[model samples]
Target: MLSIKVLGSGCANCKRLETRVRKVCADNDLDATIEKVTDYQDIMRWPILSTPGLVINETLVSQGRIPAEAEIARLLKS
Candidate 1:
């Protein structure tokens, strides 16, 4: 199983990123637990300095933008 965290300030982009992540996971049949990190302190634990950050298994994968489904699937696989 994969642990994923979507970090944002509860904005539109954040929600969209979360939705895309879930959709990609479902499409690829990946078993992932998705969590939303809205608190600034919690989100700052990662090295990301942007909104809509993505953390996979405690490693920061992306930030500031929504990643493509293919990219997300690749991340899950690795």
Candidate 2:
């Protein structure tokens, strides 16, 4: 299973990113655990200097913007 974490402060973009991530996982039929890290401290711990970070299996993959569903699915598959 893939462990994915979205780090953000629960803003609109954050929520959108979360929703997109869930949809990507579901569409891809991926067994992933998607989590939202809303706490600032937790978000900061991931070495990302921007909001809406994506962490896959403890490896930080993206930050600052919402990645496309296809990209997310590719990441999850990898």
Candidate 3:
């Protein structure tokens, strides 16, 4: 199973990103554990300059924007 993290401060964009991530996982039937990293210190562990970061299996794959569902699905597959 994959380990995913959605890092942000509970903002709208962050929620959207989390929703999309969950949707992608459900649509693709991907086995994964999704978590939300809201604390600044915890979020900073990843090299993200902005909110709404997406981490897959401990790798930061995106930041500052909500990626498309297709792109998210692709990220999970890789």
In terms of lDDT, the best-performing candidate is 3
lDDT of 3 by residue, 1-78 (tens): 999999999999999999999999999999999999999999999999998999999999999999999999999998
For every model shown, the clashing-pair count is 0, 0, 0
Candidate 3 TM-score versus the reference? 0.98
Candidate 2 stretches with Cα past 4 Å from truth are: none
TM-score of 2: 0.95
Candidate 1 is scored at a TM of 0.96
Kindly report which residue stretches of model 1 are placed more than 4 angstroms away from their true locations once superposed.
none
Cα lDDT of all candidates, in order?
A: 0.94, 0.90, 0.95
Model 1 global lDDT (CA atoms, 0 to 1): 0.94
TM-score of each: 0.96, 0.95, 0.98
* Poorest stretch of ten by lDDT in candidate 2: 25-34
- Candidate 2 local distance difference test against the native: 0.90
Best by TM-score: 3
